[model samples]
Target chain A: MSKKINLTLKVWRQPDNRTSGRFEVYPAQDIDTDMSFLEMLDVVNDELEKEGKDPIAFDHDCREGICGMCGCVINGQAHGPDAATTVCQLHMRRFQDGMTLVIEPWRAKAFPIIKDLAVDRSAFDRVISAGGYISVRTGAAPDAHAVPVPKDSADQAMDAAACIGCGACVAACPNASAMLFVSAKVSQLALLPQGQPERDQRVVSMVSQMDSEGFGNCSNHYECEASCPKEISIKNIARMNRELTRAGVRS
Target chain B: MASSNRTLLQSSIVRKQIVAVTGLAMVGFLIAHLSGNFLIFAGPEAFNGYSKKLHDLGPILWVLRIGLIAALLGHVVLAIKLTGENHAARGGRYAVSNSRGDGGFCKKTMIYTGILILVFVALHLYDFTYRDKTGDPTIVEGVNGGLSLGLFGLVWNSFLQPWHSGLYILAMIILGFHLSHGIQSLFQSIGFFHDRYTPMVKKIGFALAILLAVGFISIPIYVNVVRTPHL
Candidate 1:
């Protein structure tokens, strides 16, 4: 048997950082307790539109478990206390009636407040560009078997490569450090022979750029991994440090 | 493209290693610095005398100083180089599309704060360490109990001046920002960081960073405000 639940929603609303931002509350009832979090938002938006009030604005797409766009703090946990998926993947079945939901954007110095629920995450792209890509020579594409990378190294690279570049890291970070993201970028590439040319410079340049962006240092808050929908390991950050050190030594 | 400017910046992995090691070394320096400063409670003779002893370390001190300077320079330069490369990439934020940042690691996200601390470092080196050694910081002699050589007086005077104390606090705040991320992540970067120990490490790192921030700032605050003789 399914029981419809009632709840309160206090969500941050702002047209942009320039204007005043405030939290607005609404009494929501008759919601399917088994709906995804976004589904719950959808229900609220419908109610708001019917009442002729402006519906809350939020970032989400591909209601599935991929496409790192959906975000909200259900109670306090990013993406609502689920294991390795984003908030869009979160279902209301996990919630009880009369629960209060607080939705806010990722807060950080580098991530400027963008509308009600969106943040400018360009800084991350810049960090990736710093050395995230590998240089491949043009001509006949080499056979996949030609590289001869060890299986474990390949697996490790794939694991690090799984990062979706969501700013959840910056948002979850108290100091807003970006080591995890930078490290992920570095580790994934460094593990493969194809990434050797750029590996040294990639780690060096990306790490340097990460610092210049005004982000905080990584003090190892696993909130990033905890908040990560993919559940990326904190070990990648360690790998980045190692690479940075290795890069530093030969530089 | 010929390995010109691109190559120089990208030349060696050793350079990156130097930066990381230096960063770790600086942390070690902070610990030693704190312990030595505590000698103030040891009475003026022991304290100022300790400073003199450090100076008395002589030729060996010069070598260490050179090494420290080299480390600092290497770290800073590489850091700057890396920063430029990141900016050159992507050129701007991603288009407003269906990309939700995935969940894996939240902390992989702090290159910005790490950079901010770099700026703070320049200001700090200029203000405290450099100024003190040169006596440009206003060192006085024979004021406190023994060998008052303006060391204690300089420290007390700087903190009491409000602005100096504020700057000291500001530097400490930046240091706090750096350590809060660095210490915990250092374990991660080094690879000992794990799922079971991640939470413990985070708490330990945060606590230590906060403690250092508070302790270092307390010196300037205490000397400048509460510890003022008139106060």
Candidate 2:
């Protein structure tokens, strides 16, 4: 058995990219506490549809906290007030009856609002395309033990690999700097033997792309780490800085 | 392909490296400056002799002065450029946000303190170097049978005024705030930080910042309280 609760939502309502947006309040009546946050939104949208009003638009896929599709600023926090959890995984029970939730899209130059809460995250994809892959042939898979990577390096690579590219970091950052995201990509590759072939070129290209994308500089605020669903450590940023210095000197 | 101009000019991360290195160089200069300033505690003769030695170093002194000036200029120019880009990147501000703990006070106020320190540096140079050059007869007096403005007497007289000493103390406090973040940030920017060592590095940075601030502040206070008014 689950408890029922009523709440109010101050959600951002934007029709398109060219026009300005504002917060519109909605009454969320008789919501189940056991329901997931997205399920709660589904109920609200259905109510708006029966009345012939425009439904609130948001982005989400694989609501299990992976795939990195879901993102929004819930009450000024990226992905709501939960720690190390995505917006989709957030449950309605986290809130109390009559609580007003202020929701808005991620406000960054690189991430423009597409609708109400969905922003275009293609800028992140562009950054990845710049140098986020290795140059190895795909003819056959190598033996699992052939590389013999050090255990410490393997663990660090895995840690860096945890980033889901959800853009929460950009949303949380005051400067909108992508140091955490870019550093995660650079660190994962820099720690492996396969990623070494293009290590210098990768860092140089990726960092250049990140800058051209109009992201801010990291002043070591550590906000990205706190808001990150993956909890990616900022140490990766230091590593990327080292790699860039090495690449700059070598080139 | 050779390193493009973008790597040095437009690259925000690379610009950080530039700022970090130049900032560290300035820190080195501060340490040397504080050491020389301690010479004033050895009484007027020792301080005047050290000043004369520096004055006699001629061409070497010019080289050092030019080097310091270039470093300061590079640090300031890159800081302005990077800060502008960061401001533009934010695009818009959040309606409701909180940065209680994660956003450290020193980290956010780097620009403010940095600008303040720059203003202080300009005023300080004018007060000491320019005033010395113009030879203000009252502040600059003869010592050790020589007709030159003794550096010790000039420094002593400047601190005799309450406003001058107060401003110097305030500027040092601001410098402490700037350096508290700066020294630790230098290690990260240069890629020299480690998870195990970084904590200790931060502690050292904090301690060094306080030490430098107190060291500099003591001079004005000592001159005001202990030394007799020879000016």
Q: After superposition, how far is residue B213 of candidate 1 from its true place, in Å?
A: 17
- Candidate 1 chain B: minimum summed lDDT over ten consecutive residues — where? B90-99
Candidate 1 lDDT at B130 equals 64
Please give the TM-score of chain B in predicted model 2.
0.89
Q: Candidate 1's residue-wise lDDT over B1-231, tens digit each?
A: 112234333432334444556778777777888888877655546766888898899999999889877877776776566445434432222212122334323233335556666677787667555665435344443343332344655566566677777766886887787677666655654555566788898799788889888878777755644453320
Off by over 4 Å in 2: B1-5, B133-149, B227-231
Which CAPRI quality tier does the interface of model 1 achieve? incorrect
| lDDT by residue (tens digit), candidate 2, A1-251 | 68999999999998988999998999999999998888889999999999999999999999999889998888899998889999999999999999999988888888888999999988888788889889877888899998989999999999999999999888888889999999999999999999988899888888888888888998778789899999998899999998998887887
Report the lDDT tens digits of candidate 2 across residue range B1-231: 123347444577778888999999999999988888887777767777787788799999999999999989999898888888888998778878866235678888898999999999999998877675324532433333334446676788788789999999999999999999999988888888687899999999889899999999999998888755332
Q: Give the local distance difference test score of model 1.
A: 0.68
Q: For candidate 2 chain A, which ten residues in a row score worst on lDDT?
A: A132-141
TM-scores of all models? 0.60, 0.93
